[model samples]
Target: MKNKFQAILLSYFLLLFSGSACDTPEPGPPDAGLYHNYAELTQELARLQAQFPELAKVVSLGKTVESRDIWAIKISDNVTANEDESEILFVGGHHAREWIAVDVPLLLARNLLENYASDARTKNYIDNGEIWIIPLLNPDGHQYSVTTNRLWRKNRRNNGDGTFGVDLNRNYGYQWGGPGSSGSTFSETYRGTAPFSELETQLIRDFAIEHQVAAMISYHNYSQLVLFPWGFTNAPAPDQTLLSQLATTMADSIFAVHRVRYTPEQSSDLYLASGDATDWLYGETRVPAFTIELRPRSSSPGFILPDRDIQPTFQENLPAALFLIQWSQQGGTMTLRLK
Candidate 1:
């Protein structure tokens, strides 16, 4: 009886302590058919590069905390060489749960490459300028969101406090630790221990510094808005007029397609989000940067946008993206003042 009781006790302890023994298995990765996981995205990028060897070049910016390569695809006529051409950057997936953000940029890349042969505007954009698309910036968090928690927003940084992430969007060096960010590791908008504390944001900072990017768009989701810089403060940026004009033009282009109306406004008008990519890109590099919050104008569908809506959303945003690429070639004047 004693031995039997001891065995039972051991079994109980195992069941209590081991999550796999008692709890339901952690949810498997999301449906591969619906969305692209890190591996799938990597494969897709490789396929694009192979399909259009001259027009597309795939390069790794760096590795994530999970050691996944943060890939950036450069599309241009002379993809191999860096010529004296205006460069435009389109980044997506800053927040892991914002899967649509990733999809749009990837689709933009595809549309640009596939239509280059048939479309005159597409050909001109590629032949005359350099377009860089970094579709998945926070690959670690993205993989986690796909495989573990569907709502994970920040990068998978072991916070040393039982928490596991630092919001990459809030980790940029410009106006960091200001409003709309958190100091606590558990907060969704936690700015890391310091500016550019996370590797992902550091990679972006270095890349922007190295490249003379004329214009940039960091895609987000669920608001249907086009926002310009000064997210950290209420004060207008020195190039506010130019920024607002460009944003209005992009918003107008989006409206023309599918009759979608994306509001154009200052980033801070929506919320005071410091250390964001839009502000950092403009503040540090003087690159006219915009953050385009993608489809579904409200929280009903939120981040879990349906697969069917993906194409339509991409379709509506394409003209706006092309407009930015065209504008980059124009060499718009930027004020030297920061604020």
Candidate 2:
């Protein structure tokens, strides 16, 4: 642990003076400010909106069981008006234990907003396309993980029958209550009483559907993988070929940045999960949706990825994200290649 932390410090020192990776500025190691509690996260989102008023519009999708507002920040050139821009959604913290998940997408949001004035590529994306970020999907669960247990992974809802939370990831509406889910309220993968029963999951689904989001990326952690539907079972989607090719391209982009081997796979390949957000988004919308499991898929760190890993994870995935935005803008009509 000491050596690992030391290596992170060394990397930070090196990145402090590095030049741009390509068109965008190269990312430095994450500092203490990278991690946040629910209050801090909310404040940060408000700060971004205030700072970039013209480019950012903050909206409350709904509220959690604990009455915390579920916010999604929309970043575009004209934030006030919803132009017919190709919009893509990026969400994080589906499981509160995955601390790095929250950091990764939030960092991406910060990157795009901060670099808009200087980075032409970033400016172009914001000016022409739209990016929606819901940095903390399960704030109650996230806060619970931070305060009480370090591995809490569900919304804090008293399940009426002597239980306390439902895994929001397993409560989505598609193929729900099937395999990889549980009726046992104590289980971490409990699917809730019914599909979209949880307010948090319902808010996410409604917002995505209402906005007609062109593509989506639900971030998770501790496994270097780019996964897509059908998360419920092993059966591939009809457009699996197209989706797999795109996943490989994104995974390759991540690998190019740091040689992190993020293989592209069907979600079921890792674990059979029904009612997952990935399957519902892709299955219902027919849009390109993915779930990226980010860096250091090991038990040593697990969901507690060190702060230094945060920036590199974001740096490596930014290219893949840019590609997704551009692809979504192109109306999902691109050719698939094995490269």
Candidate 3:
């Protein structure tokens, strides 16, 4: 009888444990909405990793000026294969007001991985090379745009003397404080107290060195222009022929979709900019780099690019970005070849 009582007690304990376990719920799919915050973005990253363990992994390059995680997605067929092949780095949201910047990178990430198995073009690129995407580089600024001011343009780094934030694009080591770099901390074009002084800039610099990038695209807003290196001067970069060919191909492809004229030229020729990412990437590593300013010109409120424009801008820019990937992987010419 005592043995039977002990057996009943064990069965009751098992039932209680099973009931508690059943009460726990599973997580739902990641929300891909445009207004998703930083936490949601991180959750999306986790979901992508779980879904495509073979193709995606998160890399915490460093912390932002505001101590936010600066995350990057390294997508390829295999980690070993990535090291052997050339890398193409695509970044967006360098400027906070450019809300459209986030969609492109995130959508690109989604499209590339989602279509990796079926899309021959995506398959070929991943099979042969690495694609590094740093979407929303300025999390502090990006979040601020979503919550506070829609026109915020720099990392929220204390610049001292009562000034706050720094133009990360103009805080790189290349030609810092040179022409086009404003001295005033309050200015949008402020180069920062020193080169790479902002943690956000340092994250980019470190990532570039580690990846040995062959080509890069820094997406921006307002101006529908394809800008190359030499942001600090009018002189052309050494790989002018190759860079120009790529830019023309991209511009043509972009125009075919939207029919918008995007004049391709050196940055200095377009507008003066110093200590910028494209120049540093091109001038230092001789990698072909372009600053692609997207749709909704300056007349429009910068950060309020509508959701309706998202699909069209993404569809139009897809071909151009894919062209860059194709060029980087093949290393010969800029041509879109999709089987």
Candidate 4:
């Protein structure tokens, strides 16, 4: 398994990042197939762990209500060392319909690992800071989106009143049952029976506490927006200046590439989302956090995005993410431009 993993990783590395002196595989015809599914994702995670045993470790954070593993991968140059480092957590697939969300984090994992030695910035970040990527947070929901429905947005947990799932976004412990939360299980924004009632959210809470994470960015799709903390209410987090600066810098870097309009605002600006991940992370741990809503706003609808958009989306986001790491290392704030 380990040998196979090394081979797979090496092949992807050669094809995606480096094209010099590496063995190029045969030009097989592209299959009219869909992107990777939950099983395939788990397999990819295992393979990554096997290939980069020293730098990567696949941890079972917790299980979903359906008993699916909420897997997490920790990528750093030195995992055994107890020394503290600026850690950045990147999560994806919080909303089940966003298929591209899964790929972005996985792409980030490969990009950082494949270019660690060659790319100076990536190398510095990995060596000086830990990058944790939870490629798929809602495994059951993601799987359901691929198999049964294309619009599933919440986790697969029966709320005991005929409604199926709870919006994991509104299930966090911070400001539970607050505004933007609906008691109606029929609604898409159902807040679950109680905060942290779902094991999936609990797993994230545990991971945050155990790691003492410094910063985090969760990936979502179709909004073309970058959102900061204080989602539960309009009030900003204590480190509002720092958060704003980082958010602005990230937004600027992204705009330079695609020249797209991405507004960085608090969650309340979009809509009051109580007990959201961004609010929970910042409100609880005081770790700077942001939710990055990625690509194709009006041009595309639903989860189906073309294969051609994948590389470009990854490229645009890469710079912004790296800037955050650089900002953290310098102990600088996220910048914002006043109109």
Candidate that would win on TM-score: 1
Cand. 2 TM to true fold: 0.87
Q: Candidate 3 — worst ten consecutive residues by lDDT sum?
A: 23-32
* Best prediction by lDDT: 1
Instruction: Estimate, for each residue in 177-289, the C-alpha lDDT of model 1 and write its tens digit.
Output: 99999999889999999999988999888887677678899999979999999899999998899899999999999999899899999999999999999899899878799
Minimum summed lDDT over a 10-residue window in model 1 is located at: 330-339
Q: Deviation in angstroms for 332 in model 1?
A: 1.9
**What are the Cα lDDT values of the candidates?**
0.90, 0.86, 0.81, 0.80
Q: Please provide, for model 3 over 1-339, each residue's C-alpha lDDT reduced to its tens digit, 9 standing for 90 to 100.
A: 999999999999998787558643332343225645567777787788789999998878787767788888888998434468878899988998787787788778888999999988899898788898988899888777666666789888877688778898999998888998888998999888889888887888878777778789999886777888888988877777778778889999988987877778778886789999988877667778899888775666555677788888788888899999988888752332211
Report the lDDT of model 3 for residue 191: 89
Model 2 CA deviation exceeding 4 Å by range: 1-34, 333-339
Give me the displacement of residue 227 in model 2, in angstroms.
0.3
**Model 4 poorest 10 in a row by lDDT:** 24-33
In candidate 2, how many Å is residue 83 off?
A: 0.5
Model 3 lDDT on a 0 to 1 scale: 0.81
Taking the tens digit of each residue's C-alpha lDDT, what string does model 2 give over 131-197? 9999889987887777767777888889878778999999999899999999899899998999999
Candidate 1, clashing residue pairs?
A: none
Model 2 poorest 10 in a row by lDDT? 24-33
